[model samples]
Target: MENKIINFGAGPAKLPEEVLKEVQKNLIDYEGTGLSVMEMSHRSAGYFKINEDAMNDLRELVGVPSNYKILFMQGGGTGMFSAVCLNLMGRTGTADYLVTGSWSAKAAKEATQYGSVNLILPKVQKYTSVPRQSTWSLDPNASYVYYCDNETVDGVEFDFVPETKDVPLVCDMSSNFLSRPIDVSKFGVIFAGAQKNVGTAGITVVIVREDLLGKPMKITPSILDFTITEKNNSIYNTPPTFIVHVMSLVFKWIKRNGGLQGMYNNSLVKSKLIYDIIDKSNGFYACPVDKNVRSRMNVPFRIGCASGHEDLETEFLKLCESKHLIQLKGHRSVGGIRASLYNAMTIAETQILADLMESFFGNKKR
Candidate 1:
């Protein structure tokens, strides 16, 4: 455990160490089934139990209401771009999208093909702060009001839920899922890609309020249809059994550690440690995000002010890699350095990063 290298990648991020070890131990034979979960039939008893427990455990972990149906879907969060619009657009001819960052912007653009999409906030060149919601023009008659709870690339997060009044509030929580607790009843549909904080790639966790189901555009793919997938128990076809199995283990790990609140507390601790380095570094390091709306999950910063000191930033990344800390590079759309502190990242590992920033930049060692 002490020897494992720390990972700070955004998606396909680090999972709990214990979960990995348990999977490694059970890879050959699962519960005496004599077959690995990946090799078993989705319809088999082993797979059925795996699927059932995943749903129930997740419901309990998040306190999902009896009226909400938890469904594990595929095609990632991007797939849901179409799934969300197709399923809900039929309720009304339009929807309202609050575009704060890259993900929400993409979602809003996708909705245009299905019906009218009213972007409450126009796109910005650099998303540094979430504009006050008071400036937003929400359409009460729209089918849904959509937003991304956290934007991984922009390092922006909404500290409060947007009130949609009678209209349903839909959210894309792919990057920040499982890192904090949310009121499940407040959202009409909350979907997240599992790779960021829980489980792994290829499966998306979608919690939908029961009343929002059954409406799909005629072109909605059978696999992506929420109503069909839910009715068939997320086994409308061959499901990602291995990912679901891994997710079940991760949920148990979260519950054992301290549930969602515990994860939230840890996130605050980890992110604060790194942000402190940035905050106290003077001009050597800087974070562009508004302190209040800064993401506790993905922290994007620069080595030098304004556009960043490119040469120094390179040296800083090299120092990180040489010390066995990796995936610190920022997204191509916006270049700098990004540290994604997901649920599985340890404070000790985060302290290593914080220490590196202090020693490298604070001392002008470069």
Candidate 2:
């Protein structure tokens, strides 16, 4: 097999090569069941084992509390925006949202349809930094406190979990899920689309506190209702069998590679490699996010000042692509280069990108 390109794209990002190889080996027949995982019935014994193993491994890997139910549902993180409001907003007709970046802002907008949304922080200028918790205008009667733990587009991450007191803290952890250790008990609801760190695009993992269920708004669909999905073991309808199976393999990979702590260590090393380059570039590369609140998973940097450097940025992306370092371009909304150092990204891959950055900058200086 020819070598694979180093992928740094964001979602539908990169799966472990080992997991991909395993899937390739079992694509034709899954454990002598005479059918591919894709061909197997969702209710079949083999398929049931796959689902059970995925959930069990996930629970063990994350040390999820007994009170949390892990539900593997379809629809990406965007779907959960509405599901969160629908399920949690019935308790109090209002929700408090921290608009840290684009995703959180979008979440807040979606919640307004179901109930009142309190923009805890003022309108963000460019999503460069997360506002301090003290500056937030939180409402005591809000149903839940919502925020995106990692803003994939703007590259801002919450370094510390916010204390919501009695209110449930719901996080959209799509880009940074499984990249580090998290206290599961601290948050009432944690949901992530599997495309980032988990597995593929079709599956979304939602861990909801048991007590928070059965409280959806009257118009909530059966699929988006947490209580129905949890009671059905995340199979109220046919789940995303192939994606869940792949995610199960990923869970195994995480265990073999030293679990969550190991993933965290690797992420730090990878992110630091790029950030170090950006910081030392002496204005050649500039990261907009505050250093303390920078995301270890996604690092967005511009080629020059805030005004204009479109040509140089385009050239940098082209040069990186020529070296087989792909997907180095940032989100169009942000207009820069973003290096998404996800779990499957190895230190060697990061080093290659770092070396390219150094070479690119040196050439520009010369």
Q: How accurate is candidate 1 locally (lDDT)?
A: 0.92
TM-score of each: 0.98, 0.98
List, residue by residue over 179-288, the lDDT tens digit for candidate 1. 88899989999999999998899999999998989888889999999999999999999998999999999999999999999999999999999999888877678888
Question: Which lDDT values do the candidates have, in the order given?
Answer: 0.92, 0.91
Query: Least lDDT summed over 10 consecutive residues: which range in candidate 2?
Result: 1-10
TM-score of predicted model 2? 0.98
lDDT (Cα) of model 2: 0.91
